[model samples]
Target: MPSMFGRTTKKLVKEIGDQELRPVKCLVSATKIRRFSLIQRKKARSRFWQLPDVPLDVSLMHILEPGSSVPDAAVEVSADFSDTEVMKQQAAGSVNAGAEAGFSEETAVCRGSSLEYQIVSTPHETWTELQKRKLPDPEPYFLKQCREAGVNLYVVTETVELRNSPVLQDHSSMNISGKFSIPLNIFVKGEGQGGGLKVREKKLTVPKGSVVAYKRKQLVFKEKDWGIHHIAEDDDQETFPAGRVQKALGLGADFKLLQEEVSQKVKAAELSKDMQNIVFSNLLAMLGDREALQDLMDKLEQEPFGHLDGPGGTILTELQKDSCYSGVVSKCLILYLLETLMVLSDIQHVLLAQSMEKRILLPQRDLVRSILEPNFNCSENTPFTLQPELLAPLQGEALAITYGLLDECGLKMELNSPRSTWDPEAKEPLCALYGALSVLSQLAEA
Candidate 1:
């Protein structure tokens, strides 16, 4: 190193010594692109997004103050705060306990879990009033069983809930039926305190003169000396449901069309029901059980069902695929007839198995109606040919069957002309099929 004349200084100054930004020699080498050292195991604990594990011996919340054994803990924010606004406290344990702040008994819930909120809502702090988050006391599991046993939960006709709700019915009924038109609370027979699934509408038919257990909804009312006032929910507030906010701002006209379009789409999705059938009755009955259904299916796979070079072969293949694809099982004597019906006119493969899922019990007519568009025209005098032997099988089944209209006198169908829609006197292809089923049911009974 050549020094100019006398000497060169050993130190450099003013370089990188500003605002604690001075560079230093590496304890660890500089990372190559993203390939750095692996994350440490313990660093996840300090993250705000991670919920800290509760101590086995203590509560996660500081619910119990230092020396209070009985838990006389009370907390209140400075204002009503446009509903309970949970801003993190800059200073903890700073309570204005001297001023005796007022809040409803429900606010105790808000005070306890507001710190670790599972959910936060604005229109209503709905969960703040709940004691705990769990299934509702009147669960749907038992109700479904009751429905299967020919009992239904019935209540006052005028009760309107915005969504599907399980009205609590009396579980302790001595018989399947209970007294009708009883007060809702009496119908329920027990009072419960909990939260669970929400209610929506389902189809329930209440028979005339039949007994039903009364069902009651969970409702809150504040009974004051002046009157029994209903605590109504202001859910329709803001710019959406009530539309008052939009009207006030003079933008209602602009948004009305958009709102209508949105409403239509939402309603369509909600109302739509999947139209598919699961159980094909004839095969299941013949096989004796679902286990046999599989055994027969395996046998058919191995033996190939006696030279299926015809339409029957195609039907068998489709049936096998359908059975395998769905959680439900279905099968055939009428496969050839189905082929014929299809050849003569347009028909949905209602007899075939579903690729994904099918409704357990879709009537043949419903399956047909699914594909029948509004402008769909029916084929007149649609020729249908059936093996005369099928009639004998239908008669056998109709006799064996004891329930439904098949057993009644004068149940008849004629295949003169078929249409897309049903008429009281018009005959169609389904008439023969149903007529056959009726005969089978009757013969089985005999």
Candidate 2:
């Protein structure tokens, strides 16, 4: 396998103050929370950033015992936290949660003297701790006790990891035998913090209101709930084949007959009229003609930028700066091809990992409906035919690393037949059309 990680390893952030503020077992009603995605404007006026404060429901399932841990008294609060009095007022309410614990309504209702009021609230300086975490639905007895004691349960809205934070390394309690697994950034924006663990240092108390804002914090890493359940099922199961994958998606193809077929279709306008089809056809044309790749590169490099305050400018900048694919024609062509496919397919991310069986697997299948889902004219007999030395890197660890490009997008390629008959719902051929879309993207960085 090629040497891993040529770039300097990114440092984990440490200056974040409220990196730990969060929840354990929490309930998030999807219909209850509002999203702030107005940034992606549907039209001219829709792009306005002046969005009104939206309402969301967040209930905490765990809180520190009256004396279990100290409250935040001196940490810098994250500016992203919404503390408008109006928002709190809209959500504010005192409920005698302990009073409704009994099975009999009469017994609970008559407990007038024993009824105690407790308010719902958020905790500062604590990320949702997933260690020793319970289910989303907290036990009734446990919740009642917390209520009667005037403890407030925090519902985590987001969990940010302060990379390289001294708090994580200095504390052994953060993780033990994988029990307190480092909390992944699972609770997404606008949703209630779901099942997780929130921890406060055993000895130190975090100050209130102080939280980490967007800039100083790292937004890398996330948890997976799909394609992973089968990771442990079979040791010898057929995982994704590296030899075929890189060629089919990352490595450019020898269009040949497929190229001619696509050309004829394009000329006749038999192809879909969508922009995706035009782009995909252009890619097929590139793969077939060596001169086309060079011509495309020339155009991109020669394209003038009036002012790069636009969308494609950043991409052009990144493309020019990337020296990794500089000398290799195939690598350069594959990078652009796969990137265009990602946009056309609307597949923001692809999560593939090495399974226990020494095979590749897709762990997250959400958001991967590539529009180029119908154009793999290649056959099962001819996917690749390169020198073994060239092909060697596309197998084993290097191949795994390449698929990771879909996750981290360092970006590469080859040609191979996709098992069109493979499972359609993310297994096997993953829709040979979608697979060929002409295909893949991956993980965020710290």
Model 1 TM-score on a 0 to 1 scale: 0.15
lDDT of candidate 2 at residue 150, scale 0 to 100 = 26
lDDT by residue for model 1 (368-397), tens = 222222212333323332223332222211
The models' CA-based lDDT, in order, is 0.21, 0.24
Instruction: Highest lDDT: give the candidate number.
Output: 2
User: What is residue 47's positional error in candidate 2, in angstroms?
Assistant: 22
For residue 316, give model 1's deviation from the true position in Å. 20
Q: Write the per-residue lDDT of candidate 2 for residues 1-446, one digit (tens) a residue.
A: 11111110011122223333221111111123211100010001011011111122322222222223434232322212211111110111111221211111000000001101111222333333322233332334543443333222222233332122111111111111111111111111111222322332222222221122111111111121101111122212112211321112222422233334323322332212233333333443334233343345334534241223232333344344444434133233333333233222112222121221222222212111221123233333222222333333243233333233332321112112111121112211223212332222111100
Each candidate structure's TM-score, on Cα atoms with residue i matched to residue i, is 0.15, 0.19
Candidate 2: which stretches are off by over 4 Å?
A: 1-166, 170-306, 309-311, 314-393, 403-446
